[model samples]
Target: MSANAEDKLVIMNEEELKRKQREKLKKLQATGGNPRPARTLFLFNLKNPFRKACTSIVEWKTFKIIILLTIFANCIALAVFLPMPEEDSNNTNINLESLEYIFLIIFTLECFLKIVAYGLVFHEGAYLRNCWNILDFVIVFMGLFTFALDTINKIAGVPPPAPAVAARVTSQPDPAVRRKRRPIPLIPSVREADSEV
Candidate 1:
């Protein structure tokens, strides 16, 4: 756009805007304003349930650390569950699955904290606006999916095989089972049996 058109669009001329701001700052300083107030700890108040928490750089760092720890918890649970053998995974896997649920719960809570902290819409950078926040939200949903699958497995008494694995392959009975319940033959030689024992 031409400078003439842009100039027309501006509601306040730059000089006038600057002058107004200076006057406002002067008034604030007259009332003992420090221009920049010292940062304070964010005390959560239960009365104002929707109020955002610590907005300063330092408090944001603390929130980031909490997020990182939750990620680490997710990684640990995944490490425990993913490589486990199917035979052993059924019974023992429940424990790791429970651990994942704990992480999932924490992630859900973090999402809530972010919502209450930043708000759902624009203020500066909104919670859902940033890509990292979106990623975090996605991870939380994926964790929920895993928890649901685990719950279903617990209810069914068996985990479903992967789609790539045919049902028939895993459905086959154990190889050790024999049709005949053959009687054990007595040892032919007592001395050899004693030596083997």
Candidate 2:
């Protein structure tokens, strides 16, 4: 084709691209600038108040730094409590457990906010799209599962299983172990174990 014709075609394409970009920017601004993603499993309308709030919060550097600090705090709490000798008072253990729950709740909120800001798995830039975010999602859900299991056992008045028993239950099942499993009591005979025994 002639050079003049090619130049005209190129100019038209560039103008069209620029116009599309401008339209996108206007739509974004109309929807609170940082609206929820499209094609989400749970719908958050463009005008959802939380959609913008969460997007802004998730994108904020200070919010990320705060989450990082909380994770570090959680690690320190685990380090301090996990290695405590058996002789440590029940109060100390309870305090540590409570602190752990608080940390878990904070992490859960972070996850929820991110899922709101980005979509879950369907949309571009979704939560599960990032490797780090997938890892975070798994960790948070596992922590939540553990919390629910503990709460259920407590409500059922089932004594916490022995460490070895708990380990066996979680690991690959052994036929021999299953055969020897005893029925868990609805109410433990003793509220506190005889640590001396």
Candidate 3:
């Protein structure tokens, strides 16, 4: 209404705005200044510990394929190995061992990528809370434990028997691996044979 009253109102508004900004700045500073933004699954970046590329073979899609394949292969191996009624208790299958090694290599690459992605910022609590991240770590750790056990057993002059090879043959191919396999040639002989049958 009056010019003086208008001027006072504008000043009050500006002061309130400034106060709010100051409070926001103070809260930010108290939290160690500019908190890092939360990571999204699809739009992973260098700051995300779960997505750093550790090896030429360890890209995002490659890692995903590896994880899926590992699950499938492990399930198949377990099924094949578990049902066997081997006469000898000491006879163990080697298929499981090879699968385990493959899993270990993938996991090692994963963990290495994670370390590179996070660099020096990796926190144990954060690492534990992430699902895929934690699973990768666990897989690698279990492989390492198995390796240690095998090595110790060897050193004690009592090497464990190799697992049966059947598991390896029966294990399902990783989708990626299956795709890489050469497609069978469609020979006329095969076609004729099929037609006859």
Residues 71-174, model 2: lDDT tens digits: 89988887777443333346766888889889889999999999887879887678999999999999999999998999999999998756664555678567
Error of 1 at 197 (Å): 50
Ranking by TM-score: 2, 1, 3
Task: Give the alpha carbon lDDT tens digit for every residue of 72-147 in model 3.
Answer: 8877877766444433332346666566677677667667655544432343324445787767677778878889
Model 1, span 46-146: residue lDDT tens: 23434423234214776779778878877776776754443445755787766766777877887766655554444344567788888988888887887
lDDT of each: 0.63, 0.81, 0.62
Q: Candidate 2: which stretches are off by over 4 Å?
A: 1-36, 84-92, 164-197
Most accurate candidate by lDDT: 2
TM-score of every candidate relative to the true structure: 0.48, 0.62, 0.43
Write down the worst ten-residue block by lDDT for model 2.
81-90
- Show the colliding residue pairs in model 3: 92-163, 93-163, 93-164, 94-163, 94-164
- Where model 1 places Cα greater than 4 Å from the true spot, the runs are 1-47, 53-63, 80-87, 90-92, 121-123, 146-197
Ranked by lDDT, the better of candidates 1 and 3 is: 1
Error (Å) of candidate 2 at residue 170 is: 17
